[model samples]
Target: MANPVLLNNIDHKDLHVQTGRGAMFGDNVMSALTFPSEFRDIQACYPIVFRKADDGNFEAHALFGFQEGENLFLGMHGWEAPYVPLTIERQPFLIGTNGTELMVHVDLENPRISSSDGERVFLPHGGTTEYLERVNSTLLAIHQGLQQSRGFMAALLEYHLLESFAFDIELDDGSQYRLAGFYTINEERLSALAGAVLERLNRAGYLQPIYMVIAAMSNFRTLIERKNRVHAAQC
Candidate 1:
């Protein structure tokens, strides 16, 4: 546990705490563009391992709940599945994150093929589209669930509930692709997004305790976005 470092409350810049112990939850987590080498190789387990580690998949819906909880407790719930290993099984790929956004880099022996799970794998501008299509469908399900969920009061509340998720797909041969998981609730930047949500929910007279948090996250998201965008532009 990296010495179980005591990260203070102030240390929480955006309250993005991952729950899994070894691979999923670690201090080594960095921007999607980069990952530690140890995580980049998996001669045995492939897509299944990578899928579970990625917090953006439908299999990972509870990840947001895990994040909200980890905002308070360092230990978020570890995602588990039958084929999934308790330990993060490397799958010839790397998964990186920020807030609700995600990125995945796949390292394949073959230069021209794209694949997921145990499929035969295909090439760029090909079956990769299927994976992307599925991600879109999954997100639609999430949004539909959000729309139909019980507690929503207004568009503001609904928008605030939306989380940003992006994917960067890379192959071993340096071939790459990307897909947007969810459109930000509004084209507006983070501050505008949070403020609109909080004001709407507060006026609605619901989730007061949660509103206090929404207020904090409002500023946090803005700051993180500014920092990340600047860093990305630099890179």
Candidate 2:
């Protein structure tokens, strides 16, 4: 469970956050919830896929490993990927709503919270530090991006562009694993759409992200390679 509280300069003036990537800080996860607005950057290193949320609505995610609690991107030096999804980057912090106004909230139980070392959250005079400012921006982006994704997902469902998929992954050591319960863009359906429909998607600024998700499929090979390397080391 998370213990989230509204972040204030008075209560959190001495707070510091450990920004390094590690399983100890809860980075050992197979996937992270992502938004369409970040598909481009996420596609560069992760395979973007969709899954049904608890509310039975489709939500996007960036794949990191084949199995639960496994994150291939995490290593001794930190995350090996060129880009880290903002969802993963924003740790111990989340957006909260005070009526119609959005506010920053921090999890008190997260291991990243530190009183000494790491990035400081406030200055000596009680103003926000550069790191805290960046976190604020990240939280705002996540909030707005998720809001935008609601429309994007509705459009996909209206067009019947999402399909369930499963992958049978074979490792170099002859081990096999099944990856399932994920959804992806149906290219055949997308190609078969009428020109006017494509125009609507394009005009709505969803075409680029659609293509980005397609491009990100190529990263599965990279993910397998990382898994193979880890398997070899373990053997």
Candidate 3:
């Protein structure tokens, strides 16, 4: 459970947050929410896919492993991937709404937070620290990106461009894991789109991310290699 509270200099002046990657820091995630704004970087490392929400809406995710709580990118050292998703990077801090204003909220229960070590939340003089400034930027980016993604996903759904896929992955040791319930772009549908429809998607700025999601499937092979290395090490 999260004990989120509005961040303030008086209450959180001495607060600090550890920025490290490990299971201890709650970094053992199979996937993280992603948006079109981050597709370029996310596509380079993770397989970008879509999943149907409980509300029947679609959302994008950057897959890290085949099962829940299994992050192949995590190791004894740190996150193996070059790009960490913004959703993961924004841990322990979140944007809270005060009427129409966005305020920063801190999760008191998060393991990353402390008062004696790591990056400080505020300066002694009651101003934001550099670390907090970066957090603010990350939160803002997430806010904007998520808002844009809703419409982008809606368009994809409207055009029937999203398709579900399942994969039975075999490791070097012959262990098999079947991945399911994830969605990807239907390249055939996209390619068959009418010129006018393509123009509309292009004008809406959804084309690039669409292609990026397709390109990200290539990283599945990389993920398989990482999974193989993990399995071999445990053997």
RMSD (Å) of each candidate, 1 decimal: 20.3, 0.7, 0.8
Off by over 4 Å in 2: none
Off by over 4 Å in 3: none
* Candidate 3 lDDT over residue span 1-235, tens digit each: 8899999999998999999899999999899999999999999999999998799888999999999999999988899878899999999999988798999999999999999889999999999998999999999999999999998999999999999999899888789999999999999999999999999999999999999999999999998998899889889
Pitting candidate 1 against candidate 3, the one with the higher TM-score is: 3
**lDDT of each prediction vs. the true structure?**
0.30, 0.94, 0.94
**Which pairs clash inside model 2?**
none
What ranges in model 1 sit over 4 Å off? 1-148, 157-166, 171-177, 185-190, 193-197, 203-235
lDDT at 71, model 2: 99
TM-score of each: 0.21, 0.99, 0.98
User: Which candidate should be chosen as best, given TM-score against the real structure?
Assistant: 2
| Per-residue alpha-carbon lDDT of candidate 1 for residues 38-153, written as tens digits (9 for 90 to 100) | 11121111111111125442121111111112211112343222222212233333334456664443333322223233332223323343433343344344344333323432
Flag the better candidate by lDDT, 1 or 3.
Answer: 3
